[model samples]
Target: METELNVYLSEVTDDGLELSGTLDDSIYGFEDEFLKPFAGLRYELGVLHVGSELLVRGKIEQDFEAACSRCGEDFDFTVKIPDFTASFAVDEKTEFVELTTELRECILLTLPTYPVCREDCPGIEKKEEKAPDSRWDALDDLKKG
Candidate 1:
C-alpha cells in the first residue's frame, strides 16, 4: 500500500519542481516480524519533464528496526538513497507520472540482505563442551583387557 507519488506534467517548471514530503510507513507494506518499520519514508526530489521522458532525482530515506542476522538482536537501521534517480516514458498527452513503485523498489533493493547491529558484532556465544563422562572409563578398561 505505497503512497501515491505522482508529479503532474504541469508542475514541472524550467527550474524543475522540488517535492519534499514524508510518507507513512504503510507505504512499504512490509509485514515481517524480524524487520519492522520504525519511521516514515522521507523524500526530497526534483522533477523535470524532458522531451518524452519524466526525470525524478533526489534523496530518499527510511528508518527500520531489524533483528541482527547472526545475533538475533533488534537494532535500528536506516535505508538511504543519496542519489536516487529514475526516468519514465511519457507523451504529450500524459497528465502525471507515477513514482511510487519505482521508489519502493529502490528502497527495498537498498536494504541489506543480512542486517547486523554493528560491523564487529560477535555472533551468539558458544558454550564450551563438557568433559567426557567418567562412566566410560570402565568400558575403556574392559576393551584394554
Candidate 2:
C-alpha cells in the first residue's frame, strides 16, 4: 500500500525516516457539512520504526472552505495540524504502510464545530419590529359596532 502513503520505508532504514511532501487528493468523509478540503495537503513528518509498528509525528497544513454556521456563507480557511501524530503496526511481510486514512482523519478531527466567517459577522439581519398596520384598525372598529 505504499501507493496510498506515497512513501516507502526501506527494510534497512528501521531507525527512523524523515519525509516532507505535498499530497494532492480530494479528502472527504467529515460529519460537518460545511467543511471540505479544497487545497492540497502539505506535511513534514518524522516516522519512528519500532519493531513492526511505526510512530509518526509531524505537521500538516491544508486549505479549506467552510460555511458559516450563522449565515451559511462560504469562507476560505487554512488548517494547520501541528504535531499531527499517528501509530501503526504493519505486517512483517508488508513493504510499506499507507497513511491516507490516518492523515485525512487528523485534519477532520481539527474542524471547528461552529465555523464563523468572521469574529464580527452580524449574520442575517433581523426584520425591524413594528406596531400593527393601520389597515387593521377598520376591522377592529367594525367588531366594536
Candidate 3:
C-alpha cells in the first residue's frame, strides 16, 4: 500500500497518532545507483503533538538491494532500525509537514558504505602463479661460478 508522507497538523492530536504502513517506492529511490529498496519500508510510529514540537518515535524495517563491493554482485540487505526518533518544530501557520525527505535521509544514513553479496564472498580471483623462468636459472649459475 502507498503511504503518504505528509502529516497534516490539523489531523494530529495531543493524545498522539499511530502510524503503521509501508512507504511508497516513489518517495525513496536512487537516481543512477544500484543501492535501492527492494521492498518498501515498513514503519510503526507514534506521532505526538507536544506543545510546539512534533515528536516522532518508531521502528523502521526495510529490505535493500546493492551491488557487492568486492564481487559486484547484487544482494539483499535488511535494515531493522529500532528506536528511530525525530523531532520537528511545528510551524503554527503551516497546514502540513512533509516527512518524505527526512525519512529518506534517516534510512539512507543507516546503509553501509561498502555492501557485500555474502559474508564469505571470495571476491575476484587472483591471477595464477607462474614458475621461475629458465633464464633466471642461467643467471643463478653465473653468480655461483
TM-score of each: 0.82, 0.71, 0.77
User: TM-score order of candidates, best first?
Assistant: 1, 3, 2
What residue runs in model 2 are displaced by over 4 Å at the alpha carbon?
1-3, 11-15, 29-33, 126-145
Question: Best candidate per TM-score, number?
Answer: 1
Which digits, one per residue and each the tens of the lDDT, describe model 1 over residues 1-145? 2367788998898888999987778877876899987667889999988888888999999899999988888999889999999999999899998888888889899889999988887777732456889999999999999
Q: In model 3, which regions exceed 4 Å deviation? A: 31-33, 126-145
**Model 2, C-alpha of 91: deviation from truth (Å):** 4.4
Total clashing pairs in model 1: 0
lDDT of 3: 0.80
Output the TM-score of candidate 3: 0.77
Q: Which residue pairs collide in model 3, if any?
A: none
Q: State each candidate's clash count.
A: 0, 0, 0
Tens digit per residue, CA lDDT, model 3, 23-138 = 87667756337687767878888898887788888998888878888878778889888888988888788687777677778888888888888878877653234676888998
Candidate 3 lDDT at 118 equals 80
